[model samples]
Target: MSDHFLMFVPTDPTWQPTKADAERAVELFKSIAPNAQTIEAIFTDDVEFHHPCENWSGVDCAACGADLEDWFYETTDKVYRENHFADLSVTTPCCGLHTSLNDLNFVWPAAFGRFALESMRPGLDTNEEQEKAIAACLGSDLRKVWIHL
Candidate 1:
């Protein structure tokens, strides 16, 4: 089975939380999801993209149903050393089409010191009440993204 995570990010993409903010967010997450863990938000130039697929599987071109193995290989020189959160775009060799890596389906493990909370099982939807609670705790508007890995 794949793991699912819920990331609480600021409504503004460029906003980075301080250590105290991270701690408060952790507490807020823990109150809602007892198993929540806090990751500090780190500043990065690249925009983070998340894939919603299970276990990195099911990544195929939209125009043509082709696997992304070759596309991934051709796009990156150092495959193993590449940061999973880096900004990327995939040009489908099959159809000669291009798409943002973020637009593609994939699970993104929230990193770079961002306050991320994870739930291992699927279908654990965070209701509006819980979201409001978290927002109140953090004292800011937040956006939630689901990542299935």
Candidate 2:
């Protein structure tokens, strides 16, 4: 079975909204995607990566645009095992430049954050203005990720 999710994650990897703000954002998203089967905000103790699941295409080096899918998996695994993603710092394998797993260019628009607002099976798409409103409710800029799994 496969499911689709529309998720909004904070741009800052370690940012988390207050429970009240998260609840408000959930309500706003529900209003925007009224027919969605479920809508909620997920809070975590440490920064976690949110990928587009089966919708993922691949990733590229943010600095040089080199394909970095293999590097991404290796690096993310490294950090996840090291500290469950509590720290996201790293050096780009392709360019030897300093960066982080969260800073890489994910082709399918993934993000790392301690907070995420997600809508499951929403037969709806939000316009820019609506998106901004939800972001305001969360008090943070957001990156939208479409996930299929």
Candidate 3:
């Protein structure tokens, strides 16, 4: 059969998704998990890497995304500047597997390692607890947990 893939990205915060960031994320994901038939990622707000060295205040305002109508500045002699800014949003992602549970467990641990623990928290003092936590993260039929962020 053909390859299967799964990806879960955060709902778009802004109305726009840039080509460069999407391409970059896809490339990064491929380099790490090549056999992945399904890949998911959370959509996060665009990060501004550096400040533009230009005189265009409008450009800076757009890049930072400040809404002027939301903010106003007043000075002497009845001078008022209406500043508009951009709004920021957040996105979170998760992925699913179409392979056997064992295969998924193997690949996921190796690929995630430390980061996995960071994402998945539990009191893994023994095998029973470890399995339980894994099931919870995977939303298996073992048990249900109400986790708070």
List TM-scores for all candidates, in order: 0.49, 0.96, 0.22
Model 3, residue 24: distance off in Å is: 0.2
Give model 1's TM-score versus the native structure.
0.49
- Output candidate 1 Cα RMSD: 5.9
The residue-by-residue lDDT of candidate 1 on 60-125, one tens digit each, is 566666776556545544422475435344567778777754344332322222334334442456
Instruction: Report the C-alpha lDDT of model 2 over 1-149, residue by residue, as the tens digit.
Output: 88999999999989888999999989888888889999998998888788898989999888899998988898899889999998898888778868878778888899998988988898888889999999999899999999999
Comparing 2 and 3 on TM-score, the stronger one:
2
* Pairs in steric clash, model 2: none
Q: How close is candidate 2 to the true structure, as a TM-score?
A: 0.96
Extract clashing residue pairs from model 1.
40-113, 40-114, 41-113, 41-114, 51-106, 51-107
* Backbone clash count, each prediction separately: 6, 0, 22
In terms of TM-score, how similar is model 3 to the real structure?
Answer: 0.22
Q: Top TM-score: which candidate number?
A: 2
Candidate 3 Cα RMSD after full superposition onto the native fold (Å): 21.1
In model 2, what is the error at residue 114, expressed in angstroms? Answer: 1.1
For residues 1-149, write the lDDT of model 3, one tens digit per residue.
22222221212212323445444445544444455443333333431111111211221122233332212111111221221112221111122212211112111111101011111222222245544443344332221211222
Poorly placed runs, candidate 2 (over 4 Å): none
